[model samples]
Target: MNLSPALQQAIKEISSSQGISPEQFIVQTLTEKIGKLKQSNQTSVSQTGLKERDGILVFETESLNGIDFNELIAQSRQERDLEQMGL
Candidate 1:
């Protein structure tokens, strides 16, 4: 793969700032992007019962294992607020 000179420079700068080699940075970035793509494709938007209601996105999956998403979000919000308050 060929990268533009400016992009190469930007990658070098970012990788150096992050204390990693340019190749390592590229590999890590590509790995993260591929993982997200795989995860997004794994969910069937049409047949998986995905919906948006009241600004919240909901989806049906067997992985939930009977957990309540609303309660989980509430707990996460509480934890985030506590962390913000330096708890």
Candidate 2:
């Protein structure tokens, strides 16, 4: 909560110019910042195709298109087995 001297001066000047107390100005600034952060978080979650289901985080499978996840997993397992066998 410790602000630099220049920041305090700037806040005092700006608050005075806006006819509000520095405390009120700080509160307003923090509220706006919090709002923006929440909005940004929501936007990022949606863009990343993430969702909360039964208190667990899951990805929206619609983003996977026509890729066969089961086949991919099988292929990965096969490759791992081959590598383990030095094949």
Candidate 3:
């Protein structure tokens, strides 16, 4: 395959500096990239049962009932003033 002159020069420089041939460097790099692609494809978000809605991913898990954020914040403020929390 034909490569750009700049890319060829860069590959030659890096390979020579690392004491490896250009062909070896290219093969190792391509092998690493292909391995990463295969690994990513094997563990996709679809496999994890996460649904995408309006560009946000939602995961189904145990219900989160009786969780009140406002009450938690108010309790935290009271604790901070009374106990000097997190000091």
By lDDT rank, best first, the candidates go 2, 1, 3
Query: After superposition, which runs of candidate 2 have C-alpha atoms over 4 Å from their true positions?
Result: 53-55, 63-87
lDDT, residue 9, model 1? 98
Model 1: which residue pairs collide?
none
Residue 2 of model 3 has an lDDT of 100
The lDDT of model 3 is 0.87
Give the CA lDDT, 0 to 100, for residue 71 in model 1.
97
lDDT of 2 by residue, 1-87 (tens): 899999999999999999999999999999999999999988999889897789988888645678999999999999999999999
lDDT of 1 by residue, 1-87 (tens): 799999999999999999999999999999999999877865655467876679877875668678999999999999999999999
Question: Of the candidates numbered 1 and 2, which has the greater lDDT value?
Answer: 2
Q: Which candidate is the best by TM-score?
A: 2
| lDDT score for residue 12 of model 2 | 98
Kindly list the per-residue Cα lDDT of model 3 for residues 25-75, writing each as its tens digit. 999899999999978865786688676789888876666687798999999
RMSD of 2: 4.6
Worst 10 residues of 1 by lDDT: 39-48
Better of 2 and 3 by lDDT: 2
